[model samples]
Target: MATVSEFVIERIREWGVRRVFGYPGDGIGEFDGALGKAERAGEGLEYIRPTHEEIAAFMATAHAKFTGEVGVCIATSSPGGFHLINGLYDAKMDNQPVVAIVGQQGLDSLGTFNQQESHLERTFSDVAAYVQTIVSPAQAQAVVDTAFRTAITRLQPCVIILPHDVQGQKMVEPGPEMWQSRSSAVAPSIRIAPPLEQLQAAADVINAGERVTFLVGAGANGATAEVLEAAELAGAGVITSLRGKQVVPSDVPFHTQQLGLLGSRASYQQMKDCDTLVLLGTNYPYGQFLPATGQARAVQIDLRPEQLGMRYPTEVSIWADVKATLDGLLPLLTRKEDRSWQEKVIADMAKWDDELTAQAEQTYDDGVNPRRVYQELNKRLPAGAIVTADAGTTADWYGHYIRLHDGMLGDLSGRLASMLAAMPYAEAAKFAFPDRAVVCTIGDGAFQMLGMNELITIKKYLSRWSDPTFIVLVLHNDDLTQVSWEMRTEDGNPVWSTSQDVESVDYAGWARLLGFNGITVTEDDDVAAAWDAAFAHRGVTLIDAHTSKNVPPLPPHITFEFAKNTAKALLSGDPEGFGAIKDSATSLVTEGVERVKGALRRDDRDHGDDGS
Candidate 1:
């Protein structure tokens, strides 16, 4: 008879899980033993032990994102289980398929307040699609099956709580023939498709509109070709949600930029002006960025029925795979002859590109410009490189300036927008695809928050990689710049001094101590060369580039109120804030002035008769 641990591992292996990101602890001995035994055998699944439970969870989330399979992570009871919360929430919010196996105290403890025992199912209910405890040995197989199935089908985190006693119990014997046959059955492949009537209804709505805008998301990843075809036929200007940034290539003719606060001016204008919006598998939560009610009609399509119209009032909702739905709807679409709307949006995108390029090229007074760092990285990015960005100023530069080329994939920390996910995500990407070059842009503030320990995790796994090409770009601004902006906006000056202040550390030296190839970049001239050196390094590398904290991540459409409030706060107290505002405004005005001068010169030449 197989022990519960053996059976559980066997089942997960049968489901095609190759690696389990986890850490061992008190209540998980039996499961740990099983992993070891399997590894000793030729058919073992690799058990990668990260330094912390949170790192393991993030790694699992990234694994699932990089691959289409359900990623698994494990942690021991109570505190260990709690550590998995942040990463699990990250997975849940991002809608990645992840399975978390939590070790619980012995079943006999019986509500006596055992050490490291807590109500895990209750804690995880909000974050997981399936949350349950294996109360008995008989329930083990069924619980595992359900957890795997639910996570895969729903594309969310699933939790399986296995008590110490339950994990040690012997699996009940089914007949040899029955067990052999049943064990081979993996999770079934299921595809969701909408009815013909619903598809036709969506098509009718889309066809009726003169100016259509397509907002795509993560769910539309593999449907790029089909999305372009549908956009062409419908005369739709495409805008991506941040998570869907790489879905529609920036090089595409009709494709604009992302939407919401970190979006582009072209995207904002497109959404504001479109008559009808087509949401293809993207439930972009910010309704403010979308067309207000009564302004435009909407057609939302998704695999999940509940997600339909959750963000906006839709004229028609179709429950189906994005590509499949598009394939069915395309043939019915009335091809539009007027490409004026699309052409105008594309031109606006070109102008926005020029603005961003100018912003990236401009040098800061005190330090190397942050945008220039991304610009340098963009120039040096290897073929098929996987990039990850953290949530502060680095995200601002990465999101605004870096252009994703074809065949490249990336992770945007979606709903959580959590700090320090960049390093873990990049490390996980490297682990998942060792051959691919992995780069992460992280802020010094976020690096101090959760990045140091993860560097050790990378060092631990670096030796295993045949072609390790992991690079971390430390945008060392020495402040919580995002929070600083918030403080400057509403509160007049940052009062939470400890929270915003980041201690200056030689990150390159620190990385060197952790056994990584370290490079420090302080000058603009060395930025590209530093990145090239990091890429050329055979192992894990870190490039610490000192950048300015004064720069702000201005939104695509900054309201007068926001600017007024910010100016009020800055003028009232801080000179740095005043300087930032003055410099940014001056740069924009200067660019505008130059453009006007160029326009006048062109007009004069056009009207002037050849030197007469």
Candidate 2:
């Protein structure tokens, strides 16, 4: 004699879901009350109630990304469902499997314009791969199954809407083999390979080229070894997209960090100069950074067929799983003996690293350079750590500085590019892998938006993690720096102070108030000390890095158009701010002089002699 709510929870648990991220409201009272009873009985799913429904959905999406599990989130109707949209879009745009269960006003009040009434079906139609509402208890079990299956199979968000009254109904099971319908928990196991002809065609394009650049994306997850082996055979240098940043280890000789606006000069050069481009598991949308349409012969492998040739025109496109396709195609690729192209890519990466380090080390009179905070973070990041960053200059610094060692994990809201995801992502990562260290880098705006309220959620759940190494790095620039830079570069206008500047708040003080080990730093020398102290603690730490907004998030390879717009903006107004930007820019340009000197010294030492 179980209630429909209880039956639904049991069904999801059978699908291997142990955690449910959500918030409670009167709309979902039946489910919430049942969950409490089950928890008291020691049979309920582990429920994590984030401060806001939006964060609950964010946690669910992040859970899917970090754990490769079908993440589940629940919310009440109308406003609660409305808040879940942004986070649901994060999963949809990034292609993660997430299932959301939303409650609605009673079925009897369908057309009554009731309080908290919502037409969740029409609202969720776009974000969900499959969305359905259950009118009967019999539909509860099957609806959950379909939602989860669709999420896993398509790697997209799916929705299940339950009216408040429907959840209170008694669970029903169909009598043996009648006209009554039922569904099972079995989901399809998916690992696909493109046809031999497709794989061979892709191989032919890659094998025939003298210089190959492999642009890896998020789809390459769990296929790093196969990718590296193929790279060696094709004599290709590696360039990871932002989402694919962790696919290749940071230390690989020919593996350029990332490619695009927040990428490396090495990656930019390799993409521009390469004769062949082999795209793996990534649909990197920035075509401008890629070779001009027909400059290179290209082969693309993606799970989605529509993505195959949509971004960059490909000579051969394969619809297949990245690892499976690579497994079949590896033997066909010809191994190249020439190492010159790869060596040059490695050298360019070294020079870029030097320049970036110089940029990070540049002193600021007003505040600590944000680049320096990420640089220091990279230096101190523990082995096998999980890193998450908010959207803004935080992503730029993360892209440039943090070199994710092998086994390390890092991700963000890439396509959605939303804020307030960093803290939730970090918390989800920590929950998924309690033994691992987790870090979140966020800006003041994002941190203030919802991150502050989630501190209480984090503090409440602190005891759940065995390793207490969750660190939050908040950039206290008191400005929405990314938009400021965008206006300067894209619109050739000065920063609109009223819109761009954020009010200064004591970020560290709030963290301390919440019982986290909070530290505020403004000077260059204190950066390393702050990181060290945070690592040394046996609890969560928040480092309020008072960073300078003036130091622009410089693009890896600036186009002439960008340079011109930047110059125009600098001359327009805001001379004092632009002057600091000029200094930061100068350091990046002239840092190569030091790198050249160091390289020459190494060469002279190699040729010089004990023979002397």
Candidate 3:
């Protein structure tokens, strides 16, 4: 008879899972042994063990994001399971389907203070949609089936725990009439779309307004053509959430890159001025950047029913797959006769482009401008490249500079915004599509935290990938840059020197030690050459970019309250404030000009004013 561990391994592949990310431990020794036997036979999942269980979980989530399949990760009890939580929370927050298989002590060891004995159900309850522990051999199949099912249907993480002894036990067949003898089948692919009446109602809202803005999100993946068709028909300006940045081409005339602090000024104005807001598959959390309450008549369409109308008040809501819903609604929308609104959006983006160029070229005393790193890479990115960014300043630069062409992919921890996910995510992308080049953009603070370990994991698997262009763009600012900025902008406080400073590392040295090409960059003149060498390298390459600590990753719009607080903090002798203020003086002037432009436009609407 097959052992329970062997059966579980086989069952997941039947559900179309080909890869499993994990770290090993004695608690899961039985499952590891079974997997080993299958690998020898060349008939099992391609399991990749990350440096840590946390990286494993991060890889699992990234696999799901890149492949659009349920990602599976295995771990042992206690520390292994605990380490997986942050990455699991990342998946839970991002609404990705991931299944975690964790191990525990034997059933006999319950309440006996056994080593690595953990009741993971209580711990994972908050992050996982379904949590269960297998007890009897008869219960194995049902538990495994339910975990995958729940994860797929709910678009959330699921946890399955197995006691150490139970996995290695002989498979015992229960009597047919027994309650535990239930059989299960693999789930089939599914597509969902709302009824015609609901789609028609949403289209009616779009057709009623002249200045419409479409806010797109990751849920709109695979619906690029539909988004464009619907937008063209309505003459709408497109604003994507960071998660949905790759869903549409950044170069489109009507598209205004992204919307939020890390987003574009054009995106900000598109939201502020639009009379109609059409939300497509996005629950963009920041409400202030959106039109004020009662400012726009809104329409929201999404696959998740619970997400509809929760962010903003919508006159019509459609709960369905974004691609199918848009296809259905295309006929109902009427092409706008006036192209003025879209033309104005195009002009705004063009103007914002000039502002971004000016910001990127600003001189920094310590090193090259931080924004210049992303800007240079944006120009040199190869076709079909996959880009991943860690949380903090990297995300700011990525959101501000990186442009995703069709067929290219880009993602990060998004909602959870975890620090070290970018490296693992880039690794997983390489695993999922070995032929595609992957560029990981991360800051020094995050890179020092677990990202360096994952580089070893990359070294282990680098030969397996067909494309040799695996690049790690490490920004060295010697500070927890994002947190420092948040303290200055959000809290209205000076930079806390003790907690914010980071220990510098030879980021390129580590890569060279691992037998890969490594480049250290400090001067602005060396930036382009560093990127060129990294991309052209036939193996993993690291660019240790010494960026300026004082470069502020400015928001699309700064609130008056935040401005006053920033002034106060600078006046209070924030260590880096003076230099940062000097660097950002031109940006302040540009913001003031935009504000005047906005005031005149609003005043025009208030009175009866002529066209621009």
Most TM-score-accurate candidate: 2
What TM-score would candidate 3 get against the native? 0.95
User: For model 1, how does the per-residue alpha-carbon lDDT over 177-230 read when each residue is reduced to its tens digit?
Assistant: 432313333676546667888888988888889889999998887888889999
Q: Give the Cα error of residue 112 in candidate 3, in Å.
A: 2.5
Q: State model 3's lDDT.
A: 0.89
Where does candidate 1 clash, by residue pair?
Answer: none
Q: What is the C-alpha lDDT profile of model 2 across 138-253, one tens digit per residue?
A: 77877889999889878899999989999889999855555556888887775788888888898899889988999999989989999999999988999998889999999999
Return the lDDT, model 3, position 489.
82
Candidate number with greatest lDDT: 3
In Å, residue 399's CA in model 2 sits off its true spot by 0.3
The superposed Cα distance between candidate 2 and the true structure at residue 165, in angstroms, equals 0.9
TM-score of 1: 0.94
Q: What are the runs in model 3 whose C-alpha is more than 4 Å off?
A: 172-178, 188-190, 590-612
Answer with 2 or 3, whichever has the higher lDDT. 3
